[model samples]
Target: MSGLLIGYARVSTDEQDLTAQRDALTTLGVAPERIYVDHGLTGTNRARPGLREAMAACRGGDVLVVTKLDRLARSLPDARDIVAELTAREVKLSLGGSVHDPTDPVGRLLFNVLAMVAEFESDLIKMRTREGMKVARAKGRLRGKKPKLSPRQESHLVELHHAGAHTSAELAELFSVARSTVYRAIERARPAAPSAS
Candidate 1:
């Protein structure tokens, strides 16, 4: 008797669509019902609930299918760990319709090569992102998250806080901000303490 075909898919960002991967998996013989997915989760994150569920769903002789090795793991160590787990559990891995035979030397080599490529790609992405941010910063365009409250609003909030007419909760409600925000604004308004000589 043949075992079940379990499918897994993932996307690094919420904006990225999973339709292409899902279609590919279905075309490769994975049933839609058996497909597990993780959204807005990076491959480098090993604690994905979807991946865990798919692995747990597999039994001896069951095949775990993925459209691409990168979708399964972005790092070589993670890929190796996953393969080790699968081998120990007697589960087979099918990458893009090609079943990986751990017992074969060539298959092992190919798997390692694919994992290295994935890791390289991930490293390149990180490097490019850092360089891009550096350039943006040099051009004065890489300002981080904007403050939640405007300068004028923050000043008024601080003034209201100093007035002591309202409690922190009341100030938060009045300003439509959190109590922490109120506290931060007050803290910001404080004069800097004298430095020790």
Candidate 2:
């Protein structure tokens, strides 16, 4: 008798859709109710709740299925750890319908190669992101969030604060900003205290 097919799926960002993965898992004979998913969670993060649940749900002779190895894990160490746990528990793994036999030399080699590729892809993505950010900074397009108040406005706010005519809340209301902003402006304008030699 065949074991139950438990499926797992994951997406790195909230913007990425899971419909295609779900469809694939269902087509691979995993029941819709047995499919677990982690949204807006990276495969490198081992603390995924859905993954934990899926692993806990597996029993001896059960099959854990994923559309791709990258969906299961992005690092070679993580992939090997998960496979080891599954193998120890006597659970089988099905990657895109191809069952992985851990005892088979060819299967182990193929799984290792796939895991290396996933990790390499992840490293390339990080490198590209850093390069893109560097270029954007050079172009003056990567300046962080703009200040909440202009220099002139901040000076006026400081003057008003020193006059003692209004409380922090009143200043905030007058400037149409938060009381924290008023306090910050006053702090920035304060003269540095004399330091002892």
Candidate 3:
């Protein structure tokens, strides 16, 4: 509470705006110059330069303010690591108007609860996505990106490969694709081995 009120803001994409977060921080008496921003970067991206600078700028009694908890971190472990760092430096994290002192048991508990909720929400999203993908696959609608090579070209490529006339690299260069693509096409063309009784 005694040190400077440092603020951090982030937006996930270039199209998103940070105006609301900036205004909120400004309203909280955080000086415009003291605010750090990581524009066009995801909260999941831990190597954000602005975030690193903001953490490094924090010192004893300093308060790090964010408009929301999600704006600060994306996962429970990430949140806990950040809290630990701030605690070690004796810095407080102020979410909106509520100040969380990591040194205090109540504040630590609250932070952990919120982080767990965030992690739970992320897991639900992943599970739902997997289910959706499964359904799409069953319906023959889950085909991924279209192959760079056509079936005719693939057949020709496979024929050439079996004849040992061209290397995988050569086929990839001729087909204008990555060498891995050539390998995958060859693998798919191979007949499945007959199961032994």
Candidate 4:
């Protein structure tokens, strides 16, 4: 179906030029007004304001264009999620010269596989973080930005929370601590017993 040729462009910093992306979309016949641009946003974040606007502006029979897949999203899951949503809503998403069509059976299968790989990568990040924490714990350092409160204060908070003598808010106020700190302390102190056979 013939649809509006809407384009999205992003540059990580104000210092970076959007010339490449802009020229690409221009070549694709996307109007200047229909081109959405976000400046100074890192690709690691999917919450781009202009990108969100472009997605919201899309409707059935609309075509979303980007210079490339990387310009559209930072990761496989991000690409797949956006493509899936567009496909679901009867919108078509394409990079300027890509023959890959998510609506095609093969493309859909490939998208699913890529999405799984992205999920695995995310799991790997978590596993590495847990392992890092384990090593840090073993070293008695935890290798992170330390707590805002001193260990003694946090220990006191946990004790008070356990004794049920003070609510978290009260503890925070009494100890000159943030409410979040008191809550976190309680969580750290809460029992997490292993499953009994």
Model 2 scores what on Cα lDDT? 0.93
Sequence-dependent TM-score of model 2: 0.74
Candidate 2 local lDDT, 78-138, one digit each (tens) = 9999999999999999999999999999999999999999999989988999999999999
Clashes of each: 0, 0, 0, 0
lDDT per prediction?
Answer: 0.92, 0.93, 0.86, 0.78
Candidate 2 ranges with C-alpha deviation above 4 Å: 145-197
Cα lDDT tens digits, model 4, 15-92, are 999988999998988888899999998555799999999999888988898886666776776787788788898888
Q: Estimate each model's TM-score.
A: 0.74, 0.74, 0.62, 0.54
lDDT of 1 at 154: 87
Q: Residue 76, candidate 1: how far off, in angstroms?
A: 1.0
Which candidate achieves the best lDDT against the true structure?
A: 2
The 10 consecutive residues of candidate 2 with the worst lDDT sum are 188-197
